[model samples]
Target: MMRYILVGILALMVLAVGLLSFEWYRGQNQAVAFGAPFELVDDSGQPITEKAFQGRPTALFFGFTHCPDVCPTTLFEMEGWLDELGEEGEDLQAFFITVDPERDTPEVMKTYLGNFSDRVTGITGDPEKVAAMAKAFRIYSRKVELEDGDYTMDHTASVMLLDRNGDFFGTISYEENAETAVAKLRRLINEG
Candidate 1:
């Protein structure tokens, strides 16, 4: 009986160590030391700055209009969360930054975001400028050529959450549902 008790204690210690290691890994991955400030044109051609989004919780997604699967699904989920927020949703801002800047012109961005909530803002800028912003956000994107001259971009699908002070708070993976996403945002907002 003493031998069995010792083995159980050892197993529990191992499990505790594993759980702590996993949490540490997650914290390291999500840690943002510093992010560069950027200026980009919104769908309305209005200049948007990192300062403009300060004092409010912001959720940012990197995507393009031609995205075949991920973009639409993510946007739909985001819209549902916005709907759930109701009037207080106005306190939150959603930004869709296009990786395919060549084709995702301001006009294209405007049209693409039309179906969603009015709170959603689509942004695209010169290729070089967009690339710089993507690097700042630690977003990875690559273009794949098609049969025609057209091309498609594969980009990171993680949704970044920024605190009211414009600091990087955390990110919600694509696997998170609207409710989970909202819960995280609420916690961040309240904490700020």
Candidate 2:
């Protein structure tokens, strides 16, 4: 009986150590996997992969057209920065990807994007594809049912910025100013 108890304690210690090691490895991997490879369609109906956004630094935002506030506000802010960029911002690409692929068709995207600058490309495709792309970027989004029986999307409100070589660069806050935003782009473009 004494021997059995000693062996059992040893086994439990090994198991606990193994579980801790696994958790440590997983945490490291997830942070490194951000902005990994993805394949999705653009607003133009053409399928775009991670490679398409290469050759220029890109800013990516995931949101829905029906969003009453943050989505449009963020887009508008980014558009202002892009517009003010002029020739300097030409090498920068801003993307507005839709989380609500069901209602945000290519036409709908174009019309909605029209209110913003043409520099921001709208991306939408099959629902599964959209979800996969969001996953690759580590974006969170959910559907909330409203009292009117309709629903709205609650999505991650941050924008991801990638370097010209398609590597994970940094992020842009919705409240960032034009000067700070422009500085980030210039740095990324120069780095490339």
Model 2 lDDT tens row, 40-105: 678888877888778888889999999999998998888877777778878888899999999999
- Tens digit per residue, CA lDDT, model 1, 152-188: 9989999999888877888988868667888987776
Error of 2 at 85 (Å): 1.9
| Candidate 1 lDDT for residue 121 | 94
Q: Report clash pairs, candidate 1.
A: none
List where candidate 2 sits over 4 angstroms from the true fold: 1-31
What is each predicted model's overall lDDT from 0 to 1?
Answer: 0.87, 0.85
Name the top lDDT candidate: 1
The ten-residue window of minimal lDDT in model 1 covers 29-38
- In candidate 1, how many Å is residue 123 off? 1.1
Give lDDT for model 2.
Answer: 0.85
List TM-scores for all candidates, in order.
Answer: 0.80, 0.80
